[model samples]
Target: MRGILAGWDSLDPALRWLMRINLIALTTATLLLASAYLLGFRHTSVEIDLGVMAVSIVLMLVTPPLCRRYGAPAAIVGLTLSALIFAVGGTWATPNLSPLTALLTMVPLLVGFAYLGRRWIQVLSVVAVAGSAGVAALAEWRRTEAVSEEWWINAVVIAASLPAGVAVVVLLVRSAYARLQGQSDELVESRRRVVEVADAARRSLERDLHDGAQQRLLASSVTIERARKELRAGRHDSAAALLDQLAADNREIVTELRELARGIYPPLLTERGLVAALQSTARRSAVPVTLDVADVERTDPQVEAAAYFCILEALTNAAKHSGAAEVHVTLRGRPHLSFTVCDDGRGFDRGAVDAGGLLGMEARVAAAGGRLTLDTGPGRGTVVRGEFAP
Candidate 1:
């Protein structure tokens, strides 16, 4: 079964549909033939109907290979034309065949419209319409008292209803395919933005290491070496002073290193939770900040990290760039973990910050399956809002 399915998948999609329809037609024809033989309708040109069914099956059986050679449009046209011929021949052969059987013509019409070119669709559709009409007219002309006066009415209903139903199905398929494509595009864009943000964060980390920790460590090493030389020269007084200076320099280097590490991933976020981490960030902000934090509640670690970083970045942007006197930070724990940071500062255009500091914040939020929105304009206060899934 798996092998068969793999083989089927190898065929063009249009050819697959054509093949499936043909198989179903063959099955139905077999059933009808058996029923006719058993019901004493053997005198109604049953051999002719059997021959038509065999020919349809043969056409269907060869369609996949033909589609591969001639393309899907030609294959669909073949199947459609075969279906029309089957309906016409069967109607002529079996007086018991219902005029409503003409409705089957719509199946191929729909297939042509959905998968074939407009020119082919137009041609096939015309043929289907003409064939259905011909079947109804022939039935009406040959009718006697044995046939109901409303046989032609059934034919009209079949002709009208099948096309409408097929049209609806075609419309629905197109709509679903379009929606899938739109989502695929969005996912691609989101992935690209995430990569850009990640690269920016790496550059920022590298810059911090070079300018802060590396420079400070170099200075501290120089001081320590100078103090060692003084001690070796037996200059106790100068050596003591140099030692104290070295201690201070080393302490400064340690402090700078701590700050750099915190910037990467703060320890406060893990040890004290998002509220304490955010409060620590607020306290360090150059601008004054007010916090409306909810009670500490355990949540997904990734979500907590995203919210904390979002608020932190907003506060940093507000203090350094917004020229704001004060900032407000709000955290909510219910429904979904969320936070908002607003600053009363000179705001900048959101679109203008494409690869700016806010991108790191946006990336963090996106990684957590959250949304980050920035509302800002020149001279207007900026609002940074982030929400996460529960």
Candidate 2:
């Protein structure tokens, strides 16, 4: 049943819906035919009615294929009318037992015609009910049957059923459409948030470069210029001391620049991949970290990057804020990629720190079509986990 439902979901919308409607009609017809047989309605007309129902089941099975070969609208309309003919004919043949049974054919018609405008739906429904009644009335007269008052009851039942079915279809379709619209709106908002966060990150990078490394480099240039001036003025000792100070300043700037660059994107991540990069990060953490990374095939670069940052942030948080004695980092590769960072520490309330590193990690994971979960308690350990698809 699960496999069948999966296969049905994989079908094109038009074909799927057509087949569904056909299936429903087929089941209803079969049950009605069985009921007539059990009631001992063994006349030739009843046999003919059963034959019509059997043909309807075949027509229902064939309609989906027809919808694929011919256009959906033409195939659906033709199939609907064909099924209606069988239903009306069968009702006419076995009026004593099949009046309400004929009305079941309209179930598929209501579903199939839902995409057509309301005006067309109303017109077609009236036509179908009228045609069925006329056929049943003609069949009654030809058999020299009396004009039973029950004809009024059958007409009223069918009339009410048709409009009610249309109303239900309209309501279901509209509700589905509204749900889809809401999902679309949410996706748009998520995308906008990602873009905003990315732009903010870019600006932060620029600001850091200007304030930290760029300014230091400019000062180093001035110091070099002073050293050259002292050397030209024949102050050898002064020039030598100035050059020594310049060397120290240069070293300091290089270290600061490296730190800044690592904050943006670790060089090891690009050079050696996620495992080596994460191992380097664990080694650098203030708290001891044990890493368990599965040796498997590499994932997509984007997925690897997102996972790397998520673990990196979690480790940094655990080391800095959690005051943990030790951290455990686990990375799984293959099938689906996932990682977890856990620390046994004085955990803080999740609501209190939901914005900073946690929010960024959540955004990154969401961008990769993944999810991030954080578990923490006041005194218990904190666990940060993320799962992703490559």
Pairs that collide, model 2: none
Instruction: Write one digit per residue (lDDT tens) for candidate 1, span 329-362.
Output: 8887753467888889988876676546676677
Best by TM-score, which number? 1
Model 2 stretches astray by more than 4 angstroms: 1-186
> Which pairs, if any, clash in model 1?
none
**How far is 347's C-alpha from truth in model 2 (Å)?**
2.3
Cα-based lDDT at residue 216, candidate 2: 84
What would the TM-score be for candidate 1 when compared with the true structure?
Answer: 0.53
Residue-level lDDT of model 2, residues 1-390, one tens digit each, is 333333333233544555565556545655665565666634555456556666766665554444333333444465566557665655565454344444544544555453444665776687667765666675566445523334543343334233433443455466557646965875786677787778778887899899988898898899889999999999999999988998898899889988887878888888788898888888888899999977444667777789998888788788778889999998876335778899999998777654656667778887776668888889998998887632
Model 1 spans > 4 angstroms off: 1-183, 351-354
